[model samples]
Target: MSVLVYTENWDGKFKKLSFELVSYAGKLAEMLGTTVTAVSIGSVDQAELQKLGNYGAQKILHVTGPNLDKLDNQVFSSMIVQAASKEDASVVLLSNNNSGKAIAPRISVKLNAGLVSAVIKLPVSLNPFTVVKKVFSGKAFTNVVIKTDTRVLTLSQNSFELIETGNKATIENFNPEIDTGLFKTSVKDVEKVTGKILLTDAEIVVSGGRGMKSPDNWGPIEELADILGAATACSRPVSDEGWRPHGEHTGQTGKIIAPDLYIACGISGAIQHLAGISSSKYIVAINTDKDAPIFEAADYGIVGDALKVLPELIEAVKEVKSS
Candidate 1:
């Protein structure tokens, strides 16, 4: 049996999470004395598929069809199940992103595999197949043992580092049987924000909150993010107040991000917001109130007006870059 990884692609390129999944699965395969087989859906260049070998994919199954270009959760899960069965995979790994969240549960039920979502580390014990996962919105960690013949795991994004093995993967064409009825719902149009780093993949993130006062005052936060080559994010209330897009929201109810450095500007640091960012390697909090909850969780605390401090911070960053 092999360790199978589902490598999802977007805009003809493999996402950072895809490479991480392959690398992670390869390690698991080595532990199990097996190989790693990668599965890809939709159209991607063969050269791109082969690059997965560098991340430990021994072989790749590319499933391409006319209707597979658009993401239909039902259709995608069916393809994954078929691919896993074909590969005789004992462990199946997927990134716990939007797409994975949509399809992992369905695939687990279809394969009758014990499934774990947001796994942070490799299995502590393989005999019982116990894995550590984040629980209570990143507040705690729990070790779960899967007592099943087959197992499925959805890894948390940015949890693992990708290591290249300088190997090439053998690509094969896989055509799975599909029911056209699954295509009843079709995507009409898609709009994506351009020219900004995605928060999930960002190494550093600069976030703003209600203390920024208004949406109009977001200029300094954006500037700071640009200076640091970081992504921009917002607290949940900022998005709910219509000051920021929902996609940028980070809290217990929103996206969970684990960046290297997270700078919170004008944020009070509610428990829910802290839950989302608690995994950050280093947290810097800039707030007017020293008692703000965010300071309690911050590695560095700056008690000042964000509007005044942000501009100076941006200029300092610019000077450092120039020097």
Candidate 2:
């Protein structure tokens, strides 16, 4: 019995979530007294794939095929199902992002295995593997046990600490024959979002709200985020008002993030927004209104204008970087 992790990549480079999943699956491997193997489809730089060994992956399987380059959810899921069936993986792990959400469910149906989403912790026992996951949109946690023959789990981003080791593993190229003609959808083009850090995998996030005054005033937020090497996020109203793209919106109806440090500026904490980011390890709220609901959930609060506070924070970060 072994743990198999599906590694997602972009443009021959690996995504940060890959290391996180590898690290997490390594822990599960230890619990089950088995080894961890990573399966990656498409063409990726060999150097990037070999780096998985640093996170405790004993073997990295690279499936090279021209058709695998483009993401067809069914194709990817079928590849994973094939690998899982051949290896008899006791547990298969995937990151709960756009890809995993689509692939895991289909794989579950194909393998007839129990599936868990947004899993935050590892299983407690092997007799009947049980995992802990978040539910009610981060409001609470639940313990679920899998009684099926196999288990498939999708972990939430930023839920586990990525472990690194100096060990390097051997990479093997796998040639699987798949009938590409059966693929239902084809990827036309990947419109990449420009950013040094991805919001889902970022350790720190600085988000703004409508209190930003106007779209033009957003320069300070970007400057501060750049200085801190953090990703920028916006509130629902800001996205609705066209101040930022809907992709950057963070709330109940938006993308959920769980960074190590979350800084909320000029936003009154709405229950919906909190539901999305409440899993952050530490939260800091900055606003002029002292009684704003954001302060209630913040680990630290500053009663000041965002315009004034952001620049100071940027300067402080610059000084720290310079030192």
Candidate 3:
């Protein structure tokens, strides 16, 4: 039996999370005394596919066919299940992101595998195969034991480090029977926010909140993000007010993120907002109010007007970069 990781690609390029999954799967495979295999869908560069070797995939099963370019949860899940069966995968790994969230559960049901999502670490004990996972919006953790022989797990982003093994991986074509009917829903077109770090994958993120006051006031926030090479995000109320896109919102009702550094500007620390970013390695909060709830969760708290403070922060970062 082998450990199989589903490597999802976006616009023909693999995201950092995919590499992280491969590395994590490779380590687990070593612990389990099994080889690691990667299953990828759609079109990706041969060189890019080969790079999986550095992260510890011994083999890659690439599935390419018509209507596979777009993401259809049912179709993608079917493809993964078929590949896993062919590889005799005893353990399957996935990234607990948007696509993985959609496809993992379906694959689990089809394969009769016990699934654990939002897994934070490798199994503490493999005999019983107990894994730790985040619960209650990442405020707490729970250890879950998988009793099934076939197990599937979705790793939370930023929870694992990527290690290069320098081993070359062989690629094989995997053609699975496709139900043309699954293509009932097809992607007509795709829109992407180019030239910006995706929030989910960003190492550093600078976020704004209602405290920015108005959409026009976002110049400072964006400037700070640009200086730091960080992705820009906002709190729920900022999105609800149309100052920022809903996709940029981070809170219980928006996207969950765990970046290396998260800078919150003018946002009051509401529990909902904290739930989304509590996992960040370091948090910096800037607000005029000294007693804002966010200060309680912040690693570093600054009591100042964000509009005045952000420009100074940006200048300081620029000076450091120049020096």
Which residue pairs show collisions in model 1? none
CA lDDT of every candidate: 0.92, 0.87, 0.93
lDDT of 1 by residue, 218-287 (tens): 9989888988899999999999999999999988988899999999999999999999999999999999
Instruction: Tell me the tens digit of each residue's lDDT in model 2 across 76-136.
Output: 8888888887667988899999999989999888889999988987776667678888778
lDDT (tens digit, per residue) of candidate 3 on 143-252: 99999999999999999999999999999998998888876676778787899899999999999998889999999888888888899999999999998999999988
Taking all chains together, each candidate's TM-score versus the true structure is 0.97, 0.96, 0.97
TM-score of 3: 0.97
Better of 2 and 3 by TM-score: 3
Q: In angstroms, what RMSD does candidate 1 have relative to the true structure?
A: 1.1
Q: Least accurate stretch of 10 residues (summed lDDT) in model 1? A: 177-186
- Please identify which of the two predictions, 1 or 2, would achieve the higher TM-score against the true structure: 1
Angstrom error at residue 252, model 3:
0.8
> Against the true structure, candidate 3 has what lDDT?
0.93
